[model samples]
Target: MPSRHPAEVGYGHVVESYVTRTYGGLPRCLVLNGGRFLGLRWWHTTRFTLHLLNDAAAITDEELEALLGYEWRSRLTAAWLIGVDRRERFRARIGALLLASEVCYSGSAYCFALARFGTHADAEILAAYLDHYLPRTDLHYDQPAALGALLRLDAVLGTHHSDRFTEPDGLWDQWVKGVGRLGYPSYIPTEQRRWADVQCEFANDWSRP
Candidate 1:
């Protein structure tokens, strides 16, 4: 989708400057600049950029042609690149992707990062992930990247639910154990540990707004 705001394109130039200075090279800056304006196109451009950035070795048999192709990669990278300062601009689409059942496990970290902003939509996604995906015995326990996604999900959910969710003693333990079974890191800060607990309590509510 083209940006409703014309200035958003201009702001893309500003981001180019920032990314250029931050990366200490002009080539990466240009790529990032394309990414920002690509937000105007939004889905396709972002997906292509991410595919180029993350991997170029060879296409995979498991890749989803309709949804999981280059476009999805761009959206994922857009989520990956969005800093705390620029989150509001991409929040809606990112939130939509997270709640969709079609969202890939490989893109989980992007969703987890979005949750750090703690929007209600993000909270909803975390609740859904906890309730639906985390409990299956055949859960993709061997994927370490999935664990990063879970940790970020846990971190954000923990921040929100730490107070009320902690009333029960064993609630958090079951969660930690579940994630730990997958070989994820065990130590979440007391302040940032509640998502693990709440994921244990989620009841498969995937309803999104």
Candidate 2:
């Protein structure tokens, strides 16, 4: 992580100014322009730009869609960078993306975002995704990410549905067994580890009164 925030850097300042001037200070513009700015193309600078957008008080649907269209890695990173307060506004849109058959790592990113910022309805959507993907033997990385989201949701909301399909414990057990059976590959382990970390962080944050 960059010690200096995005606003502290010259390129960051320039991007912010452009967004304020050209887009009436919408945070979404900052996100879009940050990606377009030649000076901010480096990984660290881009991460800073995402931090800037994530810190925004509000982001419009149009803005988010634009962000989602960014490079796959950046799009996934943006999903995690977004603040929880703004998650609800993007939930339906993110859910739509998650359900799309074509999405890959970015879809998993949407799952992680929902775990951090979703409501009960959002949880239901994640559960549906988990139910849809968990059974396939072909091996998909997003399944673990989806399971992680469902687990986090259960931790935040308390156990609502006790059945195997919806319950966190059951889902977790299934994921573990599935992983064991399939054998851990490089990408699979990475995603599973990330999911665990995300779940822990979400649980900690939600525990705060």
Candidate 3:
């Protein structure tokens, strides 16, 4: 694996401090940080920062715009954090990024986030991603996250396409198997497991009404 970025390391420490002081619990902080623990991996820290921003109760448009300008991960997370309530200001940018073929894991993250907080059109965008984009990509670690996103989308919309890309077993279960077949262990971080559990709960609730 490549070395962690200095900024990522610093961000990890900062997030750890926040968890220790502000949240008073690592679990809460990790949830807000999108299942990232106190690690120095650049991608993990990046996701954590985006989740932190997303959980913030209030963010000025200027602050969000600055975040949107930071990097692809930041931009996608910002788009998700902004949610449907503030869709008008950032929808075009998010759409453009989603359509950009060069955007990678962040794009997948955006798809997951959008499915939860986006409009119908955004859901269509995610369906397009599932139908067209995901198959062509050579995803490794993030495949489960993307699969989880699709599962969430299916849960909400009652449309089933997760099995189309994964195994016949089930959503999360099959993704774990698929990842194992790809030579990666099916070990999700503790925080992500919690997140996945919550998604499963939410899916169940949505299926009710």
Compare the candidates by TM-score and give the number of the best one: 2
RMSD of 1: 14.2
Q: How many backbone overlaps does candidate 1 show?
A: 4
TM-score of each: 0.38, 0.56, 0.50
Backbone clashes in model 1, listed as residue pairs: 46-74, 47-74, 158-194, 158-195
Model 1 TM-score on a 0 to 1 scale:
0.38
RMSDs, each prediction?
14.2, 10.9, 9.5
List, residue by residue over 1-209, the lDDT tens digit for candidate 2. 11233333322333233233332233434433233322334444444444444444354444444455544543554564443344577777677667763544666667767776746876798778767766654556576667666655666688653247534546545655666676754224335545545443533343212
Across residues 1-209, which tens digit of lDDT does each residue of candidate 1 receive?
22222123332232222222332233433444333323334434444344433332222212212122233333343443442222445555554555553434324434434544545555555555445544453443212322333454546456443323233543344555676787866534343434322322221221111
**lDDT of all predictions:** 0.38, 0.53, 0.47
lDDT of 3: 0.47
Candidate 2: list runs displaced more than 4 Å. 1-55, 58-60, 81-85, 161-163, 166-209
Overall local distance difference test of candidate 1: 0.38
Distance from true location, Cα of 153 in model 2, Å: 1.2
Alpha-carbon shift of residue 90 in model 3 (angstroms): 3.5
Best-performing candidate as measured by lDDT: 2
Evaluate residue 41 in candidate 2 and report its C-alpha lDDT on the 0 to 100 scale.
41
Query: If both were scored by lDDT, which would come out higher, candidate 1 or candidate 2?
Result: 2
